[model samples]
Target: MQAKPLTIITQNEKMRNIFSGIDHIVASDSSILLIGETGVGKELFAEYIHRTSPRQMQPFIKVGLSALPAELLESELFGHEKGAFTSAGNEKKGLFELADGGSIFLDDIDDFPYQLQSKLLRVLESRELMRIGGQVSIPINVRLITASKNNLHDLVEKGIFRADLYYRINVVPVDIPPLRDRSEDIPLLAEYYLKKFAPEKEIKIEKEALRKLILYQWPGNVRELRNVVQRISLFASNEIKVEDLPSEIRNDHPMQSLTKACHRCLTNEEMTFEEVVACLEKNLIQQSLKETNGNKTQAAKLLKMNFSTFRDKLKKYLME
Candidate 1:
């Protein structure tokens, strides 16, 4: 059997570097821990790792620990023998048993019950498990991949997660960068989604619309962006303009935007005052140009600068 092809579209250099480093790790069967904020595509990363691994041909099972109820989570993960409980009509296989000779992705591992952490740790260490209410141990050979939105170490200190379990699963931790931290990828992702949602239409995103998509902080991350694109595609006839975007995105507060940019400048010790000033000026010129729809005279008037000075600055910044 051959592994199905999986694609992870990203333009960010940091993400590319991560994929490069993960190529080496995928060759081994070490337990992988992916840590990232919600909607940062941790599950997609897990799938990518599995698809690239030697066990790619085998089953890649994914279980969302947070979605499972506390009472049923144990049985869902570890199986149950006949008559194990009132609801049990026959023996059932657990996720670990089902994923034998392959890989198991335990998403939102932090939500896993604290008492069950030891059992998970034991399976990771011994490659075996016992069915619920059954005495016989079942041998298994499954690769482990876990993900968490919060830091497992913090949960450990708070006595919410086991320290030993954290150490066992975090053998090769991968921290996924947030969408805000990788804004450069926004345009690429937006265009991808636009084409995906409206393949039949000759749809194009205007420069100012793309700029707004890039500027607005995507709290829900890529998932939110995808939804927004899909909505736009359904309603937008031909081209997506700035007014076509949602009010929150279009009405980005100038003060908030400036503060965020300044915060980046303040945090970076390597950035000189002159460089920061130049960057800010370039952004202002670009924003003015977008607002005036590339009209140089109007943009100059909006920015309270002489037309000739604006042209000179544009040339200096290579905006021409």
Candidate 2:
């Protein structure tokens, strides 16, 4: 049977370039490693590779390695014969066997147990496996696609991941850009999901609401956006207003916004304590002035500083 075409709902140029690269090599069987933060849709990218590959008609199995228990991971990936363990009641094919002549996506490969790395490497190298308690070695023909939220190279450097296996899987690496880096796509995605979840309603996002969506950093990426849209769909009126957005998006927490404003000061290692303090103070003064409509005395009072002290600060920070 023919596999359904993979649909990646992205208008971002970074994503487009990534997909273009994937298309160029989908015909090859090289191991593809997808690197992205959690909920950045690594699994979707894996499926895209599989569905567009020469083995599209073949089975495409996906396994979240982090979700599986450490004790059962080996057995699950390599299969097990009946009586292999106390809980083993029937012989079964491992994911690799089931994905013969196909692709198997291993999400969170960084969480794969260290001791089992060698066994996994052996399978990838030899294209064969020996099920637990089975004598015969089963030859397999499967394409391996793995994903990691952490840089596998960093894990290897720390000795948590095997270097050999890291080299094996790092053949074709693809780095997915986070949503915050591609704000242009926010409106398109929000509109698409709104239509999907509220097909019966003429739901639309107000300009202010859409602006907030683009401004707020989506730490959870596309998944979080989808959830937010789905939740609002149930309660939103025909026009989704800024007030309809979750508080986090509509109004960032004061501290969060402050931290963002002072990000450079906080992260720059060369900045001294006094410099950082000055940076924070300047930002606070600017914010206070904006809030008080340029009323220096009111700004000073709001910041709990004497007018004289606030005047000196304004001059010091070049606000005067």
Candidate 3:
């Protein structure tokens, strides 16, 4: 069977720009480092890269490095010979060997064991690996794609990650924006998932419910939105009403509201104080727009700002 092409639904300008850049380098053998929060679909991005690459026909292996126990991680990645360890009865091919002439996506690479990083680096550098307790060297050709939930540079500085290994994997870093950063895509994604989960029924989300989805911060990003849509699709009628939404989303706590408003200030370590203020201002303007249903004049009035100033702010923040 032919492999299906990746369809990442996004109308956001930033995301479009990111994809544009990615398209230019899909054929290159350079390592790609995907940096994003948990549940932001880094694995999806990795698959997209591999699917579009020249090695698409070859095996594409994905491994969540963080999910593996440290003690067994080495054996899993580099494989083992028979009698390599007490439990090793049969020789096995490592993920690298299995992904030879293709791609290997190592998610949560920051969590990869420090001791094993050098071995990984050596394989990537030499294009060869030796099975545990085996004398023969096995050559492999695989494109490396790594994803990290945290900044690998910070980990390197903290002595938790190897700097040399970091440089080797940091050939082309791609930062995926969180769902909140690309709120414009929420409605599109929601509709996409609605049709996906309930193709038989032509269900639709009510305007108010969609507004709540767009306004509420998605801490889990796109993954959270998919789950929400899947849950509601199961019980939704012709139209999904506000009451049909989850209670937490319908009745956001005041503290959660505050956090949402100041999310950039709190979570982003790279943002300066001024940037945080600008973020807050942009968020407030966005909230007003959502509340007034995209009526610029009404949104301006709701924020108690002069129409010209509001318009300028909207243009300044590129919301216009």
Candidate 2 clashing pairs, residues 3+ apart or interchain: none
List, residue by residue over 100-217, the lDDT tens digit for candidate 1: 9899999999899988889888878888999998999999999899999888998999999999998999999999987867999998888888889899887898999988888876
* Pairs clashing within candidate 1: none
For model 3, residues 151-198, the per-residue Cα lDDT tens digits are 899899999999999999999999998787898999999999999999
- Candidate 1 vs candidate 2: the TM-score winner is 2
Best by TM-score: 2
lDDT of 2 by residue, 202-286 (tens): 7988887888899876767899999999999999879999888888788763345655667777888888999989988998888
Q: How accurate is candidate 3 locally (lDDT)?
A: 0.87
The top-ranked prediction according to lDDT is: 2
Q: Lowest-lDDT window of 10 residues in candidate 2?
A: 252-261
lDDT accuracy of residue 145 in candidate 2? 98
User: Candidate 2 or 3, higher lDDT?
Assistant: 2
Q: How do all models score by TM-score?
A: 0.79, 0.81, 0.79
